[model samples]
Target: MKQVEEILKRNHLSVTDSRQKIMQFFLNSKGALAHADIEKKTGENFDRVTVYRTLQSFVEKGIIHLIPTKDNSIKYALCKDDCEAGHHHDNHVHFICDECSKTICLDDVTVPQVKLPKGFTPQHAEMVVNGICGDCK
Candidate 1:
């Protein structure tokens, strides 16, 4: 809880109960989480609208980064310490476990550089590898 509060403070966001709880959830989580996942984990203590707003705020503050899955269901995971507003350094590979369906950040495995066509400006990149995780395998 104290660490969550400090994170919020460092991100220049006002500390609130919802933010603290959400931050703690991310900190303890092993993989990215969807909106429904968070709701279920919190026992539905927070309203859907509140959770949505909190997620948006966290994304804007760079406390978390969006993970886009093949099914189009968006998930979020904690950002690295260097991530900040308008800049996210989570340019690493995300591994999705086939058995458990968990999406974890492979921080050690960075995304390879891609050469784009002329006149194209690359902003951000995401790479997700789907396979059986070590535990499942």
Candidate 2:
């Protein structure tokens, strides 16, 4: 798609079919996607390693981000913020809908700041809320 091409150019990543299809999947997605799910979606077009490598490159380019799930499996979602390579400002809470089991990025809800004792430093913080989404309610 034209939009996908522009995003790839803006990110300074060369346009490729693998990247295009994978990125499109994220673009049209409703919520976070697991690696296996992505593979299943693109299995006929790409191999497992290609999908994995593409995901890693996308993360490095800040096109997508990782979401932590309760079962320990990671998921990917598009970066709504102005994320740059090696630097991302996706400091917001993620929501997991209990009814539909979808992972959504609550962009308007930011993660709460935590207080640390003296001599301690904080690098990053993330929050995941599990509930029924508005769609389900």
Candidate 3:
């Protein structure tokens, strides 16, 4: 709870119950969490709109980042890097375990840069690898 509070304070966010519960969920999570997962974990304490707003605020504050899944659904995980407000420094790869169905962020493994053709520009890139994680092995 203290850690959650400190994170909220450091981010200059109000320490609301909904925010605390949602932040704690991320802290206790081992990997990325989907919207449904967060909704389930947060239980009936908050509505979908509140959860959505909180997630948006967190992302805007650089408290978390989005991961694109194979199903096209989005997932979120805590920012481990020195992510500042309005800027996320995470450019790492994401690994989804086949056996356990867990999505782990490979923070040390950066995404390879792609070469674009002339007159073309790249704004952002993401990489995802599917395999069994160490815990499952």
Instruction: Count clashing residue pairs per candidate.
Output: 0, 0, 0
Poorly placed runs, candidate 1 (over 4 Å): 80-90, 117-119
lDDT of 3 by residue, 1-137 (tens): 49788888888899999899998898788898888888887665588998999999888888888888888888888856633333457589999989988888887999999899999889889999999999998
Report the C-alpha displacement of residue 20, candidate 2, in angstroms: 0.3
Write down the lDDT that model 1 would get: 0.84
| lDDT by residue for model 2 (1-137), tens | 49778788888899999888888888888789998888887555688899899899888877788888879888998866643333457588999999998899998898999899999888999899999999999
* Candidate 1 structure quality by residue, lDDT tens digits, 46-133: 9899899999998887778888788989999885553334355748899999899988888788888899999999987789899999
Computed on alpha carbons, the lDDT of every model, listed in order, comes to: 0.84, 0.84, 0.83
Residue pairs whose backbone atoms clash in candidate 2: none
Off by over 4 Å in 2: 42-44, 82-90, 117-119
